[model samples]
Target: MAATVRAAEAGENFPVALRILPARLRSELHATYRYARYVDDLGDELTGDRVAALEAVAAEVRRLYAREPVTDPVVAGMGPLVRRAGVPADCLLRLVEANLRDQDHPRYQSFAELLDYCRLSANPVGEVVLTIFGAATPDRVELSDRICTALQLLEHWQDIGEDYAEGRVYLPKEDLDRFGVTEEDLGAARAGDALRRLVAFETTRAVAWLGAGAPLVSTLHGWARLAVSGYVAGGWAAAGRVRRADHDVLGGQVKPTRSDIAAAWAEGLLRRAG
Candidate 1:
């Protein structure tokens, strides 16, 4: 709980693990936070011993898949949700494997590769949320994939500068080359026209993908729809921010304000009500 609180306070991962959850969900949400934190920590903190840390994460994932109760706080907390939702433990285990994959391979060769990574890194979270809402179905799952993938791409596009600063790149090499961008372009302090165009192109695709999933907001009810709509709206709002910034992602991360989120919330609710 303490670690979860600190992470939220520090504003890592959108304060998602602890803030604004129903009172009934706080405990389990914190547990999920702990699990994600550990996986991330293993990848980032143990960089010097990355291979070993990845092996441990993989082993734990295997154990979880084998139907062993994970004694870790988050894993322990997940047991109830898992049983209640009939969620495949494999999803949780795959999360671990995905984090390890990040340590081994961060750069993507193509848009398809990036989307594949998003499937591993981001899609399962939406699936779990759908299960939590008792709305998991094949159709909703497909919509969830589109929304999650869009969010993942928006995050990547907005963080191009930050990622490059950290000696990593999320921009697909193929797209970068198509836009006449190079590794040297990323090494710049601010984005040049080439990089800007690449971001704009990727942002367009993300917006389109998000739109494809927007109808799911109508397909959901109660707070479940609110949650999904909020996530989808965030992607749209983020894209708007990026566009307003003229795709100057190198300036800094242009995040939507709480007012922006509230507007999205209202828009979603009104649409759902109709």
Candidate 2:
């Protein structure tokens, strides 16, 4: 199956700049997102030594850049985009490194550690988007990093239960200890006071990041502006859902509903217009 079909069938929640971009740009962005999704699935879902599999995937990406034959359909599909749009090879490589880190470290020792992982896992996609859109200045890249990291953190909070089921824990050990939340607390059907407090702390951090990076939206115009604003809005909306749920991530998957995402996008458009 194609990467796009696989991602749709698997129901991955990864977002791209598709909704607001022009048709041509939207196609490029979708192809890029699909490639990333393919790499992530290889690392997370497939059995065996994921480290080796990720390395092989990275090699295919390198081959694509080198104009060599790429066996994987997803990598082959990304070839024209990477070649034409100047998508940085290093940025895509960082994503593979992030997944490799997952194999090496199932739990984070500190918030800083988690942020480092986000730098690898999440920031690259934002950078790739900006690069493809011709808006990747150093300032914009910095802002994009903030938004992407915030989104990654928010996703982590929302999928705490799912991650736990996979034998991975994104909540920093220090925070859990600080809040007196044990691993058992995370596995509970409902979040206890300690887990709630910990989630609240994380939510505050994500909110701060969204606030810090929100300016990126106003820095552009047209489709790029709308796309970035939607990204910022999505982060805000997801974080809002977590807050609205009173940080009870264990009770259910804490994610924004469709209406929440629509509201966020509209609010962002209005803010840009005003």
Candidate 3:
């Protein structure tokens, strides 16, 4: 819970899942935290036998519900909540599985390939939450896809520099070639017009993807609605920030102020009332 809050408050993962969860969901939140932090950490750390580290994470999660097995931080952190909430062990495992894939492969050739990564890296998260809420359904899952995938794309666009440093270029090579963008362009100290145009196009795609899922706002009611709405709105707001910055994402991506979020929330209320 603390780590998830830190990630959210740092404005990295806006619409922090913890804020709107009911009292009963603290455990599930912790389970989510345990899963997300490790999945993300594996990618960031990228150290010392990636396969072994991934296997270790997978083992820890697979053993989570076993009554007699020792509980590590992965289990210890969320053990209580997963027990009470019965968060699917498979969902957590899928996250680790994705990280394993990330360790073995980092470059993505197309938006479709990138989205396939998100199926594990991001989508399982929404699936896990829906399971916790007892709301898993094909229909709702479709909306969740928009939210999750947009978040993933938003993150990739924001982390261009970091990804390049790791020898991983997520921008499809085909797109780069089509735009006449080169490694030199990305390797430059700052983004030039071509790069800016690329980011603008990509950023526009992410914003529209998020908007396509806005109906999820009304799909959930009260806290749940507010939570889903905030996520959708936050994605839109972040897109606007990037757009407002003239799409110089290398300089800095747009981040939402608390007031920006509050304004979004208030507008959501009005829309709901209407």
Candidate 4:
């Protein structure tokens, strides 16, 4: 599991900027990442009874909160940070619940439903990170939700083909129908014109969400500011990649290069500074 987590880190939408962060903060963030990745792997890759596996992780989360011994190494590793940051049990449990939902809910009916799934799968991570930095006010959490949800949408946009192959479709049925994108279109080697149009629409929506959450960067200070800016930068870089591909997501995964991320990072900081 440890090795798998490390390998998966390279492909994350927002790579942990470990070099720029303090040692303790890096460790804390990595612990959180490990826990999340472990749960996701169980839901998406496990060979048998994925729901049961997620339920086990959910039970471990409850144990962590109740001061009982945790059997899962990743959850047990989160003990110190959770206690130190006063991280809410519900935040972590929501992650587990999201995976549980994945087991039963393979397709989303609407964009609102997709956002609700993001509430469970993505927003809680931001909430926990803010709590660790002692910055999770209600207002900040609201902004973080926008940012997290945007990031989740960007990921789904990038992985449309891969997700469809796995018998899961993150694209809402309503949006697909509106754009005349059949499920068969999603599995093709290249996106048809209608699919590209749908992707462009979804990309625009994600970018707007990122813009709505951009204020969260200015509201933070020091490392927190830098970290949040990096996240926003990542979103921008990813959106640019999609646009540069003409929004044809089925051609390949739209991943931003390191240089793209660095350029976006600098631009984000400058914009925030100005």
Candidate 5:
């Protein structure tokens, strides 16, 4: 499980950038990552009653906060770091709630509804991260929310086909109707013009959110600045990939190469410097 978790984390741009941090910080972040990933797996990949599994995980999180014994290895691993970092219980619980919502709510009706889902599913991770860095101020968290939501939308746009296959659709129903896209379009081997236009519209919104959040890098310092710049850069690089693909995300997962991430990272840092 440890090996699998690390392997999966390696593929993400955020974790890839965290490699440069000090060992202690990396370990703390990894513990949080493991717990989040474990919960996500329970929700998405578990064989038995997923809601029950998630409820059990939530219990473990509460136990961790109570300083009681935790049975789950991932939750046990997070206990020390979460306690030490003063991470809020609500942040973790909100994540579990998001997964619970996933079990029942597969399709989002509007972008506002999708954003509400992201408030639960994505934003708390950023809040936890900020808390870990001792930087979870209201202003910073507000900015972090934008970055996190943008990342969530980008991932959704990229995984449209896969999500549709899983009986889930992250794109808003209203947007689909506006673009003349249907569930059938998501299942196609390639995106048609209508699907491409829908992706383009969503991509534009994501980019705007990312841009709105980019100033967060300038507000941070040292490792925090570098780490956040990497995140924002990854978002930009991903947006670039979608644009370059002409917003046809159904061809495959549009992953940004390491070189692409590096270039964007440098450019972002330079922009901040200027």
Candidate 6:
């Protein structure tokens, strides 16, 4: 139902699990992602009275939670899937709140503060996925948190140029100071040594966090295992891109190639098979 909305939000980059999940589960996941993506776009892309648009979206979210007849297409499509999966209402709301936070606070002062933002932005999606898989144990959720947070950090690094152009900066001011990078460095088209060093440092942190979360892969079976491993591999592959580019993100966002994704996917499957 929300397939069109999902495409509008995320151009066919559905999760790796979608390839293996049953049609029903796949549809549910699509709806879920579509809802999140809709909220993000409302906050990030809507021009002129964005706050009003987001407020309207929030009202739609509230309607979904109330099981009322939803007028918004995104909420109507997602409400049933969310209810069926028993995903916590707060989890989805947190995603909306994250985008809301972005409307007000685009630049973070500290890494801790940025992580707090990720709690709202990234962690809820992981929790929702875990719920869908029936693997929302506290231990698993903890592991999922690590993976989701790492993925979010990697995404921030990848979108440095685009984010800066939008007047958003995900890099913490403290880290920038420590690495001797300035806002001007990030704004430039070319990255200098200081900016490269800062990017390297941030990517290393993401790698460490992803590595810590990788063990969650071994704890699952079948498609879930493959899916989690693919996520981990994605983080690593993205980090590899940054490293390969020598962390010069000012030119453009570094992304994993098809070979990188294929190799990482295979490595994930092999790891599970062993």
> In lDDT terms, which candidate is top?
4
TM-score of 5: 0.97
> Which ranges of candidate 2 are over 4 A from the true structure?
2-20, 272-274
The Cα error of candidate 4 at residue 252, in Å, is 2.5
State TM-scores per candidate: 0.87, 0.93, 0.88, 0.98, 0.97, 0.92
Give a tens-digit lDDT track for model 5, residues 87-199: 99998998999999999999999999999999999899888888878889999999999999999899889889988999899999999999899898999989999999899
- CA lDDT, every prediction? 0.73, 0.83, 0.72, 0.90, 0.87, 0.79
Residue pairs that clash (backbone atoms under 3 angstroms), model 4:
none
Candidates by lDDT, descending order: 4, 5, 2, 6, 1, 3
Q: Write the per-residue lDDT of candidate 3 for residues 1-274, one digit (tens) a residue.
A: 5655466446654655645477766456555756587667766676677788778777877676666574566656667756765767777777777878877687777888887888888877776666666666778878887888898788788778777887777787777877778866776667889998998988888878887867766676556665667667677667767777887777764676766766767776787688
Residues 166-273, model 4: lDDT tens digits: 999999999999999999999999999999999999999999999999899889998887787888888999999999999999897688877788899988867756
Worst 10 residues of 5 by lDDT: 10-19
In model 3, which range of ten residues has the least summed lDDT?
4-13
Off by over 4 Å in 6: 1-17, 269-274
- Which ranges in model 4 have alpha carbons more than 4 Å from their true place? none
Indicate the TM-score of model 1. 0.87
- Report backbone clashes per prediction: 0, 0, 1, 0, 0, 0
Query: Mind giving the per-residue lDDT tens digits that candidate 6 earns over 71-128?
Result: 9887788776777777788887788789888988989999999989989998888788
Error of 4 at 175 (Å): 0.6
Residue 161 Cα positional deviation in candidate 5, in Å, after optimal superposition: 0.4
lDDT, candidate 1, 1-274, per-residue tens: 5755574434421334335667545555455556666666667556478767667666665566567856555455566766666766656766677777877686889989888888887787777777777888989999998988898788878777767776678898999889999987877767888888888999999999998988888889876765677677677777878888888888765777666656766776677678
Task: List residue ranges in candidate 3 displaced over 4 A.
Answer: 1-9, 18-21, 65-70
